[model samples]
Target: MDDGQPLFRWSWVVSNWDNDSPNSIVNLLQAHIVMSAVPVIVGLLVSLPLGLLCVRWRWLYQPVSGLMNAVYALPSLALFMILLAVTGAEPVTVIIPLTFYAMAVLIPAVVDGLASVPEHVRQSAVAMGFTPLRRLVQVELPIAVPVVLAGMRVVAVSSISLVSVGALIGQGGLGNFFTDAYQRDFYTPAIAGIVLIVLLALVADGALVLLQRLLTPWMRARRSA
Candidate 1:
């Protein structure tokens, strides 16, 4: 369906940047970064305690995991539509739903990470008279960082991708390009948006991997062994 239209024109992408509107590519990119980051941060905070509770009880995990799965399964578009009434089409509406999505992944990661701590380690901490709270914060969570960050890597990428869907309600960040391109029968914005989104995901994932290694230099040594 060429329709005598050039599929991609570099000038169009440049023009999108040059455009002074709030919907300019630069503005959307900034919004995209902020919108994608806030949810993951909030979700991680929320998951830590919930994950701890599940680990402590064991019985609660199945039900709590099920509930989170249900929340994750809700279509983002539909959730955005529903949230629009309460948040009124703001970035929060997108962040709120993505937070649940992040938790759906992070909670399980947290549980599994905590569980991965060798029984001997916990016993040694107890033998050292480390209080439960102190052991958890100083000993357990540090060891759990790699696993939890693994989950966070996934959440970050997924959140970045999902934020594009917010364009449906006008808060989609770079996602606006997709909608705008379709409406205007143009291609440059859509292509640029995709490339940028992918690059952002890669950068974010790489940063998390670096953070993991930095936080657990011993693990890196073990891997070399």
Candidate 2:
């Protein structure tokens, strides 16, 4: 209640959070999750291959990597606007720019991770007649998993915040709550939506940390020791 009434009126929001149905916060959240997941998955898929290519071809590394770095420097809102013009205020518009953004961050991280693999390990694998495919899967990837996961964690958390901007285009999410609340002059709901986004980000970050610990037991053991 801002000045005397209930601040957020949980009951009201709970009842009216959906796009189709009356009380569909569930749908709102689902839309956000789907929107966020698409770009993350697509970006990772695209970046991993490019990262590998960067690792394989030393000459092209500087220029290709520089391009990704430049893309990373582009403002998210600007990218969104450019996409909006082409895709025209649809979910695709949001996802395309977000995918590019994710790639900008992920490709560099993946390349760095792959580079961090010990030179001795690569030499040993090559000497053993391991095919490049086998070497990558059996030797290089395992060592790079922790670093890649760390980069993904950063992207996942960042995407949650960035995805909220989709609400500006009528795409649903906690962003809808925020946009609607502000338009309707309802501070409580707006605050509730912002709080929910923050909480969601924290939860996602915590889950990634847990996953890192699970996946990199050797690192955990060393740290504990």
Candidate 3:
């Protein structure tokens, strides 16, 4: 048995894969996915309406947008700490800060997307008896979908990476693997976690690219036609 301890052992991780403990790698992954998705979905819901409002009201463009820009500039860890203090290490603590992070990234993209809508197209929509809401819903939003999706892609990638910070507060994820590995000097699992996070980011990015292509086929057809 090699002195009753494994030399070059893979079983430490492999054997524990089916464990039901909160700290299990599978549990970590589930927690990470759940935590990250909460913020991205909530942020999108909150930001989309505000984004639409900003486009409709010129006054909101400066103050509200500027405030979100300020939030974006705050470091992720700092925001996390602030939320932790307020919410006391609960899941809501992490979710709230992450939502802010998502919003910070998303709101600007939404603004840019709306602003990028061609002036002529907007005018045409108005002349075609389209109400402002109808014009925004039908013309502006469809054209802006690519940019909005791009923002979501950015947030998804950032959230995956930022989740590592959540490990500091006893949260689970590949981040926990990272922290445990660092503490116990286990190099392989640490490297594995890093690789997994990177791969997740790449996969999310690729999926968003495919989605954009699928959603904007008219843009492709026009270029070819």
The candidate scoring highest on lDDT is 1
Q: Which ten residues in a row have the lowest lDDT in candidate 3?
A: 1-10
Higher-TM-score candidate of 1 and 3? 1
Model 3 / residue 50 / CA error / Å = 0.8
Q: Clashes in model 2: which pairs?
A: 1-5, 1-6, 1-7, 18-24
Candidate 3 residue pairs that clash: none
Please, what are the lDDT tens digits per residue for candidate 2 over residues 1-225?
246776767777656655576226767677777777788889999989988988889777789878877887887767777777778877787788778888888888888889888899899999999999999998898788788888888888888888888777776467777788778787766776688778878887898899888877888786889
Give the poorly placed runs of model 1, Cα more than 4 Å off.
Answer: 1-4
Model 3 TM-score, 2 decimals: 0.89
TM-score, per-candidate, Cα-based: 0.96, 0.89, 0.89
What C-alpha lDDT values do all the predictions have?
0.94, 0.79, 0.81
lDDT of 1: 0.94
What is the per-residue lDDT of model 1 for residues 64-167, given as tens digits with 9 covering 90 to 100?
Answer: 99999999989999999999999997999999999999999999999999998999999999999999999999999998998999999999999999999999
Winner on lDDT between 1 and 3 is: 1
